[model samples]
Target: MLKIQEIRELIKLIDKSSINEFKYENDGAKIVLKKNGSGESQLAESHAQPAAVQSVPALQPQASVPVVQQQDAMPAAEQKEKVQDETLHKIVSPMVGTFYSASAPDQPAYVKAGDKVSKDSIVCIIEAMKLFNEIESEVNGEIVEVLAENGQLVEYGQPLFLVKSE
Candidate 1:
């Protein structure tokens, strides 16, 4: 998929060029250019045909299977995952900027393993362009892990903090 910035660049290039038609592929997107007889540039539109899909076989239950056994298996899986939850932590981002956990100037780190944090604690700062957006923790517990590294771009729902919620 082409980024929003790349699409803007394509539009600019089409306007400046006197070529009637242009087609190029960049960043996984097919760009097409078409022009009128008078050399008027037109917006590029990519056309793609859907591929054929193969049939998939659906799983069926055997007549000999017991409903009680199936029910027991479902609960066992859930129990395993829930038990491991304590050893795991969730990382969440704070803002709409790049995420960086480490500090500059040859510093060690703002956080690490076995770190305790409160719900309102500042886990990390997200830098958007030149501004710094502080990310805060939503849970109070011990820091189990870090989800994103320093200077990593993060989306709104991107994980940035990991804590072992008590």
Candidate 2:
């Protein structure tokens, strides 16, 4: 059986490569990994018959998801600006995990549509293996949309927020 660290390293490596799927088996041990919608990843392993399947979060760059800007907090009139263009920037998830709009459920969201932000602003948080990773914006602009819902399962490189470049 492979150690947890080895499995994690393999996952990181596979995420960077173009190979969509990978499978390996030897001496009664088996492992399988595959990419799903956009960049989400699924992994399965077994040591014997009737293998047990488990869900694993994807690992991808944070700026890869492409999406348009649309925010709920903006007025309808302001929301219509430059929406026809497909060049708006996006803040994407760095890893597969549960996405949270705020630090706590009851607290206000860290960012919403129509909010101005800098390249280093914190947009949201992603929780994986009991660790919370604060996702930051890589572009300076006005947040025009929030693509991922609060507490939603976000895949690697999935679009979390859309920003209209300044």
Candidate 3:
């Protein structure tokens, strides 16, 4: 298995490059990252037996990765709506994790619709591998919508919130 830092580096490199897909396999472990037409990327990892297995090893369950295909164009009405909302910016997840609207169950949400935020504001939290990560708003804007529900599973690059720029 790749270390967390290595995985982070790989994600950064892939996001900055023109490549839309990347795959790596070693010692029964595999990692795949693919980008959709909208430039959002999804990550998947699994362990597989070697092609030329000489002996049967302990069987382990495989991780399932959902495949989603997007159409090239939206319906006319949707397209018109999208055009009108072109100024909205999406705050996407930096990794696959469980989305949390607040730090704790009793705590209030970090931000809500209509809340004004600056470029460095914390918008939400994403828990991955038992670590709680604070997600920042990279753009100065007013929160328009919260896309991910509390405790929902979010994929890498999945949109968590939409903001209208100031």
Candidate 4:
């Protein structure tokens, strides 16, 4: 179990560092934190007006969900719809490796939900054996969902994204 003080300390570190994303794992548990561009900017701006630090960390218990506004959080709900739909297309991993969404620290993510993809489109970067491999989409369609989080380990034939049939 995670101690309250430890969780609070981690939150402080996240806010202080310019690197908004971090991950750490041990034998028993794993912790990950990321900053949403809109969310962070909004919080920062709100505080700049009041001259007070927005110190409350957004953490909802029992749910491993990223904090976002209700409207911006539609991806999770839409993701469920995509899963339930009878889509016959999926972007599968070609090799067993760790999946990365961005090419480098300064690069934008390869793809996100609602992006149109083609058979030649590079949808993600899969790191295998210390090499970063660009994983391409095998189908031509709109990307409806991304199944894996950035930096998550993936296996061969794993369904990384669900694409609606063209």
Candidate 5:
């Protein structure tokens, strides 16, 4: 069996690497790690034990039926909002971590909605594997929305903010 620290290290290494899946088994203990298309990692573990076998049933094929698709009409306001959203730039997380809106508990948040920022502006921080990384806004714009809350667990490529670029 792997220790908690060892598992954490393995997760960090796998997340940084290009490998999509890993499996290990030893002394009836098994561990599996997988990453999906969305860049999120999943961990699975099992301790093997003896079990009784049972009979299973087979499935029969069913006839196929034609499918129809319907689209709902959107309100004018919603359509306009969507169009504006499309024009906004999204600030996304580069790695999975805990999002921090400020440098410390007593400090003010780095940026808030309606705050104007430059391409080099530091917008927030993400803590991963005990390391705090400052995240920068890559676009010059006004922050239109803050998508992640303070101390929230964020995933890689997850949008953190929406900005209206200048």
Candidate 6:
């Protein structure tokens, strides 16, 4: 995630640029920086809030999943194993920002499902205040699931990826 100092720099750059709005996205994070006619800069976060609202109704229909209901009384060990089998680790957002999977529009994505990563590997980018910051993996693992989608706004501490740690 872009630091506060980096955001300040980006705001300064926006003040000097002719652009009234700047938007950046990677993975599922999104940052939208806007300059009003009076030249006042404002930062807005983008997320799946609208989609979340829509998904609630869709999930209601799944209440009849008898299999899941039966699993509610699972043994402690089995429950732990089931959870472990699902995800070994999560890559979370350090700050509120837009997530980007690649450096640029034409660039290939840094990683995808089944991709392996080391502790220092660059997994994605988070843009805050018009500045892009490369986010590194903190664990050695293979990506199991990408939780966020490109251009989605992610909140601080939001899970961005699920990794099966090595």
lDDT of each: 0.58, 0.77, 0.78, 0.67, 0.78, 0.72
True-structure lDDT of candidate 4: 0.67
For model 1 the local lDDT of residue 2 reads: 52
Candidate 1 residue-wise lDDT, 1-166, digit = tens: 4543454466457667766566777444465555554443444333353242211111111223323435355688787865775466676653356776654537666677688888877777777647776667777898876767776667545656657887
| After superposition, candidate 6 runs with Cα above 4 Å error | 1-82, 85-87
Q: Per-residue lDDT tens digits of candidate 2, residues 1-166?
A: 6655576678778878997888878778787877765665567666665544334445432234544455787787666764643578978887768999999988999999999999898999999768999998998999989999998998766888888898
Q: Can you write out model 6's per-residue Cα lDDT over 1-166, one digit (the tens) per residue?
A: 4545565578679879998978867556566677764666666544556453211110112222232345778999999977885657988887667888888889988889999999989999988768787889999999988888887777656788888898
Q: Give the Cα-based TM-score of candidate 4 against the true structure.
A: 0.49
List the candidate numbers ranked by lDDT, top first. Answer: 3, 5, 2, 6, 4, 1
Judged by TM-score, which candidate is best? 3
RMSD of each: 16.6, 8.3, 7.2, 14.1, 10.2, 14.6
After superposition, the stretches of candidate 5 with alpha carbons farther than 4 Å from their true spots are 1-80
Per-prediction TM-score: 0.45, 0.65, 0.68, 0.49, 0.60, 0.52
Q: Per-prediction count of colliding residue pairs? A: 11, 3, 0, 0, 0, 11
Query: What ordering of candidates by TM-score runs from best to worst?
Result: 3, 2, 5, 6, 4, 1
- Model 1 is weakest, by summed lDDT over 10 consecutive residues, at 53-62
At residue 144, candidate 4 shows an lDDT of: 84
lDDT of 5 by residue, 1-166 (tens): 7764466577779889999988978888777777665565666666666352111111111213423433247778888987888899999987768899999999999999999999989999998768999999999999999999999988666889999999
Those runs of model 1 whose alpha carbons end farther than 4 Å from true positions after fitting are 1-91, 103-105
